[model samples]
Target: MSELYDLTIVGGGPAGLYAAFYAGMRDMKVKLIEGKEVLGGFLHHYAEKTIWDVGGIPPLRCEQLIERLSAQARTFDPTILLGRRVDTLERLERGAYRLRTDDGQSHDTRTILVAVGRGITEMTKLDIRGADRYELTNLHYTVQNPESYRGKRVLISGGGNSAVDWANELVGIAREVIVVHRRPEFGAMERSVARMLEMADVRTPYVLRELHGSGDAIRAVTIGHADDEEEGTGIERIDVDAVVVSHGYTRSYGDLLAWGLEIGQHGVRVSDQTATNLPGIFAAGDCATYANKVKLIAGAFTDAVLAVNSAMRHIDAEAPGMAYVSSHNEKFREMNKRLKRPL
Candidate 1:
């Protein structure tokens, strides 16, 4: 029989990663399962973007934050599973929970923590046929490296924050930037939109109609008025060295929602203590919703601590309500000694 863990964390985003680390401080056996092959969750989509809101941390690229979080998650050597999509959850006869992944592997845990932030997400790709062929070349759904498009004429599609933000970021880097949006009003901060308008060539009420490319690179594109039904009127062709599409993402919770947990508009409903409707089950991160919840990386960390504490109390009613603060905790004595060793 597989060993039953004290806590099993679903999703390896900020919440799950932090829970794994904090659970170690409580001396609980932990396991974390991530659906994707890598950790970091949705942060991988904006790896090159700068993140500044995390408390006590200086501004750093999202990728650097992911690296730090992943490193911290492994501090206690918790069992980490990657590329496993959890398919079902079942309550065992003894009140323990069984989580079965799509690969048919089962994990037994005394308590389950649902931290699948926004569930499994996939970027919304460009709709134009044959657009994918250029993905390997000049077409980009994500900006992994801003330097890649330096000195190139870049065409961006979408009106959301990501689209506008990327356009603004590329203003001084790219030789020229052109933004095409279906709506006249962009769905980004007013100041950012104003900055983009003052820099990039902003085209409103427009949609990418076609791509002109040879081999694996797009050399030009045709854009049309959003309301042009015939696709023949109000057409304009623009030459470009690269194209960026930021259409947002699609999220799927899989069978997780069918497990009878209380579902809210944002996600699985949980109490202030991070306890879910089900016994021995809790939630955290964007996947867990409560009154006045803050939806940011820092907020996810707070949720992780609360959920881990709740899970600890669920496992052993006599256990302390929360782990001792790191500065005063005895669990890190050996770790601190190791850190002090000469390099």
Candidate 2:
């Protein structure tokens, strides 16, 4: 709502949140705009899921890690605008930048950190007939709870990491688990694919072509080869209780590319300092590309620290020191006590 800020980060994920916090360390007023309803971003979907790769933390659940990261990010209380999509960015005649959002909200900032990971693309849809009717009702794109499918026949579609992971997790809870994929071979990671293939209670290689049944709940599904040209005869119908679709995702770059920002196939290109080709603008996280950039959560934190430092320097011209403590200090007591050590 305000007209200006020292920094405005266009995401609320690890990169954006960390940027806000690091910027705050330099005493800069910051705002983080997250397009989603929640602050954790993709991690919110697998809140109970454990993360093993983070350096110091020993496999904490996605939710726990997010909560701890969020606590540290919010230490300086940056303005967090959830469910707001950044629609456009315009350069002002006087040298500031205006960030416009879908909800008609705008902010003028001296520097912008674009950490909007993957650019707001939604989960892929199943695209089967009759699926639209049940999308918000019975058919779901996300697995909200495994208990909801207890003792019920469920079909999960996709051969990707998310689909395979969900199928592996639901084997014990659902009465039956059927995983359908378009391709003959699953494109998921080796470990997940192996686990899904080994699940005795789950079925695989079934591709959904249509939906059957009516009313409040699903009854069955029609299947066929993803490459099948025939419509009806090659189709096989199977009885089921619920359908979970996890096809994958696409980036939503929209007009940002045409608006003059340098973009690659995955995202915008940036320097090591997170500076994009455009002056006073920077990008980080999944929406950024640079030498030595890594897409992991841990990597994003480093990107945030560097991006914030660069943004502050852009504003002050001669800002002192790194925005965040480059080295952890022994005397800097218990601020991130909630952070769990790696196992």
Candidate 3:
């Protein structure tokens, strides 16, 4: 028989991580499961980008924010299972629930917090044949390090926010930056698109037709007008040090969406208190939606706290409505003693 946890959090993103930390304040046995081997959720897609919206924190790299959130999540020493995707959910007697992962392992919990933001997202890969061979070399789906493209000619393919953002970021770094998009209009912010067009070489209504390479490295690429139906007609080949493909992403909720929950176009429908239709189940972050729900990092943290508190009350109706503020909570007494402070 699997040991039952007080709360099981699916997804290790900002909301899930913060929930784990907040659940510790309620003294609940907790477990967190993340589909990817690493935490941070979709943040890993733009790890090099700077995040300025998180409350009370100065501007910092996204990867650093992930590090801090992951650390705070471990304050209670909850069980963390990585690289496991929850595939099924079964409700048992007495409001107990069993969650099975892709690996066939089961976790029994009295309450659940579904925070799997946007489910398991996969980047849209380049459609060109044999393009994957260059992934390990100069072909990139994401810019993990902007410095790596220093003094090099780089070509970015796509019209989304990421594509335009990367082009702007590489302006001073890359010796030459070229952006090729199939549509004349870009999907990124108007200001950002304008900035990118002003700094880099922007080609509209064009698409990458072929990749020329030797061994595993891409040497150059062939691009042509998107409207031209002929394969080789009206094409131009340009030399490049690196090629970045940021088509977009495909989101999959897997069996989770199949579960009997009030799901809407945005995500699972929850109440102001973060309660789902089913008892002992709640949701947070982008995966959960409510009236006037704010879809931001700070909003995710707010949802996490509400979901944690609701989970605690579901377990014990007599429990407090919410945890005391961290400054006033007894749970932080010993933790505060370890911190250095001025006399």
Top lDDT hit: 3
Q: Residue-pair clashes per candidate, as listed?
A: 0, 6, 0
lDDT of 2 by residue, 228-341 (tens): 676775677889888898878765643455657788876788887889999888888878997767999988888888888888888888887484363564323464465485
Runs of candidate 3 with Cα error greater than 4 angstroms are 340-343
Write the residue-wise lDDT of candidate 3 on 1-343 in tens digits.
Answer: 5899999999999999999999998999999999889989888888898999998899999999999999999999999999899979998888899999999999999999999998888899999999989999999999999999999999999999999999999999999999999999999999999999899999989999999998889999999999999888889999999999999999776588777989989989999999999898999999898999999888899999999999999999999999999888888888889879722
Per-residue lDDT value at 236 in model 2: 78
Ten-residue stretch with the least lDDT total in model 2: 324-333
Which candidate would rank higher by TM-score, 2 or 3?
Answer: 3
Superposition-based RMSD of candidate 1 using all C-alpha atoms, in angstroms? 1.9
Candidate 1 vs candidate 3: which has greater TM-score? 3
**Could you give me the TM-score of model 2 versus the true structure?**
0.84
**lDDT for position 69 in model 3:** 95
Predicted candidate 1 versus true structure: per-residue lDDT over 18-85, tens digit per residue: 99999998999999999989999889988998899998889999999999999999999999999898
Ten residues in sequence with the least summed lDDT for candidate 3: 334-343
**Model 1, stretches more than 4 Å misplaced?**
340-343
